[model samples]
Target: MSVAATLSPAADVRADFPGMVTGDGAPWHYLDTAATAQKPQAVIDAMTRALGVDYATVHRGVYGRSAQMTLGYEAARRRVAEFIGAKGEDEVIFVRGATEAINLVAASWGMAQIGEGDRIVLSMLEHHSNIVPWQMVAERTGAQIDVCPLTEDGRIDLGALEAMMTPRTRLVALAHVSNVLGSVLDARAAADIAHSVGAKLLLDGCQAAPRMALDMAALGCDFYALSGHKLYGPTGIGVLWAREEILGAMPPWQGGGAMIDRVTFEKTTYAPPPQRFEAGTPIITEAIALHAAIDYVAALGPDRLLAHEAGLARQLRDELRALNSVTLFGPEESAGIVSFAIEGVHPHDLGTILDEENVAIRAGHHCAQPLMDHLGVPATARASFGLYSDENDIAALLRGIERTQRIFG
Candidate 1:
C-alpha cells in the first residue's frame, strides 16, 4: 500500500469550507464526519444561488427560471447516479436520506415480493436503518429475518452469511461499511452470494459512498442507498439506486402527487422508475446543493481524499493504541474512523469533555446497537475524518481524551 504525505495539504482542503474559520474562538476540531460532513463553500453557494435567485418547482413548471431549476435538479440526479456508477441515470431515486430510501425499498419492493415463509438476510453489523426496515417488512409479509454473524475482528463473516442464506431467502440487506467498527464489507462478494441463493441484495451505502469508490452495477446488488449529508452534501437529500427492472415492478412506497402518470377516483397508474419513488414536491434546493457537493468531491478526486483520510486514521489509531486505558476496535487498515473506549470513562462524558475543548466526536451506539452489543459496550467514541480533517484534528482528539482521563481517572 502506498501512502503519500504532502505539505500544507489539509490547509488547502480546509480553505474550501467556511465553517473552518471559527471567529474569535478556539480552533474547532471536527471529527464527526461519519455523522455528517461539514459542507464546502461550493455546496453552500450553489444552494444559496438556487434558493436566492432561481428558485422554482421542478418537473412541473413551464417558465424560464422553472426550466433552469428543473434542469439543475435532474442534472444532480445524473451526477449522483454517475458518482456511484449506477447502470442508468433513472436508477437513482432521490429521497430524504438513506433511512427513507431503505424504508422505500422495504415497504415497496419488499411488500410486493416478500411473503409468508420468506427470509430477509441481514448482518449483525447493520445500522438500525438497514435492520429495522427488514424487520418491519418481515412482520408485514410473515417473513423471517436472519442475522449474519460477524468475525471477531469486526468484519462480516462470509461463512456465517452463506450459512444463513437459505433457499427461502427473499432479500439480503447489509451495510457496505460498519458504522461503529469502521470495518469495510466485501459487498461484491456478499451480493454474489445473495444472488446465488436467488435473493435480491440491498446495501446501505451511507458510510461507503463518501469514503469509497462505489460501482453499483459491479457490486451486483439489486438496490443501493446512500445519504447526501454524510458526503458534505445538503441535508434532506439522498440517493436510492435500484435496477430499472426491479424498480419498475415494485409498488409505489408512498402515494401522492407527481408519482402517478394518470389517476382516477377508482384507479391510478404510476410514473417511471424515479418519479414513481418520488411522490411529493422534492427537496429541490438540497438536490442542487448535493450536485455541487458531488462536483466538489470529484474535483478533489476520491482517490486523493481517501488516501488523505486513511493516513489520518492510521496515525490516530497508532497513537490511540499506545494509550494504556484505551481499547480500540476494528481492522488495522480501516476507514477514516477510529472508535475506542477508555477504561473508567463513559463515552458520553468523554464526548462532553471533548466538546468543551471544541473537539467534536460522536458518542453513542452510532445506530449500530447490535455491533455495540457485540463489542460488549453500551457506546464508544468515534472520531471520523473527512476531506478537510488534518493531523491537528487528530491531535486535538487525543488531547481531549487526555483531559477526559485527568478529569475522570
Candidate 2:
C-alpha cells in the first residue's frame, strides 16, 4: 500500500545503463523491460572482458587459462545459487533461457515421471514457451493438462487451483508473475496445493526474478526457471533451479562432450546433476556477465525494485483511468508492467507512434495468446518498467498515447 510513498524518494539508477539514451543523445524511455531488460555498464564490461581477454572452453583443458575460465564459469553458478537462495550450486543448471529450461524439464523429468492418465496443471496466463513444452510432453506420454483460471482482476486464482487438484496431478507449473498483466502469483500457496496432491511445482520465474526477492527453499517449489536477459544480463544463459533430489533423479535430456563421464562403444555414463544438465561448451562469457548482473540487482535490492516499479504501475494506472477513452487490464496493484487499449486505435498503431517518441512498448498477445483470447482482444499496449525506469518514462508513454488518441480523433 505504501509502495508509491517509498518510491517517491528512491534514488535513480538509470545512469548505470548506457542504453537509457537514444542515438541522438535524447533520453529513450524504455518501457519494455518485461521483454528484455537493458544491461548495466558493469555487466557489459564483465562480458567484454570475458569474451575478449579471458575467453576459453570450460571443463576440458587442463591448461592455466582453461582452468581459470572453468573456475569463473562454476563460480557464476554459485553466484546464482546465492542470489536466489538455493541450497547449493549443484541445484542450478544453465540452459539457453527460460524457454529451454522448461523444455529440459518436460523432456527429462516430465517424460520420466508422467504417463498415461497423469495430469499437469498450468494457469491460463502462461507464456507460449511454458504451454507448448508441456503440451508436447503430454501428447507424447498420453498425459493430460489442466488450465487453472484467473480471478476477475487477472491474478492466478488459487481457490480454483486448489479445486483442480487431484491425486492424478503430476506437476503444477505456473508463472510466478504474469508478463502481460503483471499479476503476481501466490507461489507459496500454489506450491502447497501442488504438494498436497503429491504433485511437483515448477515456476516460470522470468518476470518475478527481476521484480521480486526470491528464496528457493522458502518458496517450497520443486523447480524454478528464469532468463538472464530479463534479469538485465546477456541472452543465451538462464538458470533452472530444482531441489537437488529432484534434479538428481531426472535423466539428462541433451547429450554432448562435457556432460559425459565416460563413453564407450558399449555404454556411456553422464556427469552429476548440474554438469549433466549442461551439455557441451556452456555459456562462458554469458555466465560471467550474469554474475555481474546479479550483483547489480542484489545491491539495488529486488524488494526495492519491486516497490519502485509497482509504484510506477500505480501511477500509470491512475493516469490511464482518468482518460475515458482508454480501457485498462490487470489489477490496480501489480509489478511494473501496465497493459491497456485505446478506443478506436490498434495497439500496433499506438506502438508505432510511441516509437517516434523514443518510447518502446510491447504491443501484442505478449506470447500469451490464450490469455488474449480470454480477454477478447487481439493485442494490447504494454508499458513495462525496470529498475532504471522512473516517472519520466511514464510521462513519455502518456504523451505518446495522448498523441495517438488525438490522431485517431
Candidate 3:
C-alpha cells in the first residue's frame, strides 16, 4: 500500500505546544526542525520541575532526594527503550546526542573489533557524525572505508551496496533517513545485507526517530542512535541502543564516575551493560524531559503524526515543484523534508529572506558534504517538518519564496 493510503488522521495535537503561536501576533513558520525541534510545554515543564522541585545527582549520591532522582533517571531510560520498542531497558544508554552516541561506538566498540585489513562500509547519505568517526577508526586501525552509492532517485543503491559487501567488512553504518534529501534507507534490508557479509549494522536514526516507527529487533541492527532534542526533547540527552550481547562485548567508552563496579589502587572493574556505558554524571533533568517528550509523541501516536506530516510534505513539494525557478532533490515520495535550489540564488540568501518573514529553513550542505557532492551541489535549502507544522506553515514558506524571487529577479 502507498504510504499516503496507510496514513491515519492526526489529532489536533498542535494545541499542546505553545511555540506554534508567535509572540508578535504573526504566526512563526518553523521549518528547520530536522536540526533541532521546538519543545512542547510538557517537555519544558518536566525539565523545569525536575530542576525546581527536587534537584539531585543520580546513581551515586546516597541521600534520599538523590535516590528519588536516580529512579526518575532510570525510569527515563525505560521510557525511551520502550518507546523505540527495544527488548529491554538495559539496551538504552544515554549520551550527549547522536553524535556522541556514534563516537562512543566508534571509539570503544569499533576500536576493539576493527583492525588492519578490515573494511567499514558506509553510505553516501550518512551525516558527518556517522562518516567521520569511521574515517578516524580506519586511520587508527588501518581499516579501509568503502562508500555505498546513491541511486538517481537519491535512495541508497542497493545493488552497489551489495557489491561493496565483502568478507572483510567489519561494520556497516548508514543513516535511517538522509538529513539532506529525506530519503529513507531500508534498515532491515541493509541489516540483512550486512549479516550476509558477517558485518553488523549501525543506524544513525536521528532523522527517523521522531517521524518513523522503530523496532530494534525488527531492524536487526547492532546499534541505533538518536538525539533527544531532534525528537522534541531537551538537549544534552540522547540514546544509544545496542543488542544486549553487543553491549556486553563493548568496552566502556569513557571513565570517571558511575561506570565502575570496584575501584582499587591497582585495578578496577566496570559496571554492567548500561551504567558501564554511562560514565560520569548524566543529564538527569534532561533525561526526564526526554521521557516527557516520548510521552508527548506516544500520546499522539506515530501513525497519526506521520499522516499529518506526509500531507504537509506532499502539499509543499507539489507547490514548490510548480515554481519555475525551483529544482527539487531526492525521491518523489520523501519524508517530512523538501530540499530544493533556486536558479541564480544562493541558499544562504534564500534562508536570509525566509528569516525576514519569520520562516526558518536550513541552508547548507546539511552536514553531508559527500552527499552534496553526489548531488552536484554545494548547498541547498531544506524545509523540515514536525508535529507543530501545519498547512499554513507551508503557505508561509511559499510566500517567503515569492518575496525572495521578486527581490532577486
Q: After superposition, how far is residue 142 of candidate 1 from its true place, in Å?
A: 1.4
After superposition, the stretches of candidate 3 with alpha carbons farther than 4 Å from their true spots are 1-11
lDDT by residue (1-409, candidate 2, tens digit) is 4456457423457788999899988999999999999999999999999998898888788999999999999999999999999999999999999999999999999999999999999999999999999999999999999999999999999999999998899999999999999999989999999999899999999999999999998898999999999999999999999999999898999998888889999999999999899888899999999999999999988988898899999999999999968999999988988999998999999999999999999999999999999999999999999988878788899899889989999
Per-prediction TM-score to the true structure, in the order listed: 0.97, 0.98, 0.96
lDDT of 1 by residue, 1-409 (tens): 2242462246677877877656665578989999999999889999999899989998888899989999999999999888889877989999999999999998888888999999998888889999888888888879998888889788889889888888899898988887877788888899889998899999898888888777887888999999999989988989899999998888888899999999999999999888998999988999999999988888777777777887888888899989879999888777787899999999999999998888999999999888899889999999998888888888888898988888887
- TM for candidate 3 is 0.96
Q: Rate the local accuracy (lDDT) of all candidates.
A: 0.87, 0.93, 0.89
Superposed Cα deviation of residue 328, candidate 3 (Å): 0.4
How are the candidates ranked when ordered by TM-score, highest leading? 2, 1, 3
lDDT of each residue in 254-345, candidate 3, tens digit only: 88888999999899999998999888888899999999999998887876776667667787889998998999999877778889999989
Once fitted onto the true fold, the runs of candidate 2 whose alpha carbons sit more than 4 angstroms away are: 1-11
Model 3 scores worst on lDDT over the 10 consecutive residues at 2-11
**Which RMSD values do the candidates have, in order?**
1.7, 1.5, 2.2
Model 1 CA deviation exceeding 4 Å by range: 1-4, 7-9, 23-25
Top model number, lDDT = 2
- Residue pairs with backbone overlap in model 3: none
